[model samples]
Target: MTESTGGIDMDEDSSGTVKKFAFINRKAPYGTVYALESLEVVLISAAFDQDVSLMFIDDGVYQIKKGQGTKGIGMKNFSPTYRALEGYDIEKLYVEKESLEERGLTEADLLVDVEVLSRADMAALMEEQDVILSF
Candidate 1:
């Protein structure tokens, strides 16, 4: 059985079953802690040997956008962290095409490479996830 600490299972290998974990990010990178919090949780889940994926929709796309300038707002830019996700073996990243079009952005505007999916396709992907944590 997995050992629990403060309600979180600390044993990464206690469960032999590998579950697909999808993190849906729908908020902007800053102004709120949701984006950063989601990123942290995704890393933790990946470390647990779970199949992890991140979906960026709505303003969440901004989290991985390149050329982000947070210094003017007294905040440190964390966009580069998204690029490092590959080192953790957590690579499945998706962005909603509609969201990018609405914001006048394209894949080139993103810092890390991500598959651009249509709203319908994104929904289909979400349905395949064993667990979804939205932020």
Candidate 2:
């Protein structure tokens, strides 16, 4: 392992290289498995103790929207799972400001606190990551 930013360990894999992770969510909640699967992966990744960032754009912001109810659709609402992420040390959540405004949503509509970013800022943040996974 080599020295990392902020003095964290830069772990080497079988190939002897470290990678940063960025997860992008662009799908709405409950309609498909994307949202749920992303959450699962984020939790798992957090266990690795690596640098991880989650970005929500487009309809993806709905994954963390408050007041989610699926009783009428016969599905279990998993949005509450976002609340526990902080316990796992996964606090880097970025939501696109434009996306929220387009959907008529404000920061208060979200279930958890997130750093809202402009499109350009989000793009720059994504560019800083070594591995980007979109769901």
Candidate 3:
């Protein structure tokens, strides 16, 4: 069994089982391509009926902040689409507590409800996932 220092046991082949995917997003919504790409990945994963979850760390938390107005930049604000994730069965969303504090944001600042996890807790949660994709 290959044991990861992250404490993840990757010994089992989960081919036929429901795949658990954790997407780690650590980029801002605009001024970069990470956020949009991450969203597309989420959509594609959901389309495959995989159990997908999103974890926003660092500046990525801003992607889901409420009242995003990008019309000034001639871009359609995609904040509202996060709410539509539930329709695709992509429900588990997480935000790192330290990241929120570093950026001076609170749970009230987000567009959707998210589970706030400590860095250690988040690491443990990541270890439980069958796959992790970071962007």
**Against the true structure, what is each candidate's TM-score?**
0.88, 0.86, 0.86
lDDT of 1: 0.86
- Count clashes in each candidate, considering only residues at least 3 apart in sequence or on different chains: 0, 0, 0
Clashing pairs in 1: none
Off by over 4 Å in 3: 1-15
67-131 per-residue lDDT for model 2 (tens digits): 98899999989988999999999899999999999999999999998999999999999889877
Q: Which ten residues in a row have the lowest lDDT in candidate 2?
A: 1-10
Top of the candidates by TM-score: 1
* Model 3 agreement with the true structure over 53-129: per-residue lDDT tens digits: 89999998989988899989987688888999988888899999999999999999999989999999988998898
The C-alpha RMSD of each candidate to the native structure, in angstroms, is 4.2, 5.9, 4.4
**Which residue pairs in candidate 2 collide?**
none
Cα lDDT, model 1, residue 41: 80
lDDT for position 116 in model 2? 98
Each prediction's whole-model lDDT (CA): 0.86, 0.87, 0.85
Number of clashes found in candidate 3: 0
